[model samples]
Target: MSEFERIGPEPARLLMEQGATVVDIRDPHSFANGHITGAQHLDNNTLTAFVAGADRDQPLIVCCYHGNSSQPAAAYLADQGFARVFSLDGGYELWRQQFPEQIAQPDPHK
Candidate 1:
């Protein structure tokens, strides 16, 4: 298993409040459905370009539907020199359950 710091919704919220950049790694379709507020949708496909322009100095919080995808994504960001990178413990699902107000609701028209 890969070593990762699993953060709960409260801590995640604090991180975001403190200027952490939340990166959602789910597919664009799923992202358009819903995601955390202010999260940047990079998806698995556009990671390279996203990282190129991303601020390495900023704290990065990565998330996915269940947390599986965000692990490697967070690791990749770390490898790319991001100072602080984290994966949401249980991904957006747990986040939604813990902080309903923070989760972005899906748009019906998509």
Candidate 2:
């Protein structure tokens, strides 16, 4: 689409159900603590491999702590050739609040 759009929890959930790839840009610890189910954590360490392997034409949703950081990250992914890029409005925080049942917590033993 050449640009990223900001989307709220409900719309993001719908897109996810339709096979959108969800990426969490928060730190590893934060991601491990709690994140959207099926979310892939992305950082500088994994960005290259992610971009190299991801389906550019598929919808992608970028998430962060409070929704601020994801804007630029979404933009970057859009620039990288993603056809539909979205930033989760209010980010993981709002998602957790609105859909706690959708959250995935890491197993302590893992």
Identify the candidate with maximal lDDT: 2
TM-score of each: 0.87, 0.96
Candidate 2's C-alpha runs over 4 A off are none
Task: Report the Cα lDDT for residue 31, model 2.
Answer: 97
lDDT of 2 by residue, 1-110 (tens): 25899999999999999999999999999999999999999999999999999999889999999899999999999989899999999999999999999999989898
Clashing pairs for model 1 are: none
Q: Please provide, for model 1 over 30-88, each residue's C-alpha lDDT reduced to its tens digit, 9 standing for 90 to 100.
A: 88777899998986577788888888888889998888888887887888888888988
Candidate 1 Cα outliers beyond 4 Å, as residue runs:
1-4, 107-110
Task: Give model 1's TM-score versus the native structure.
Answer: 0.87
Please give the CA lDDT of all the candidate structures: 0.84, 0.96
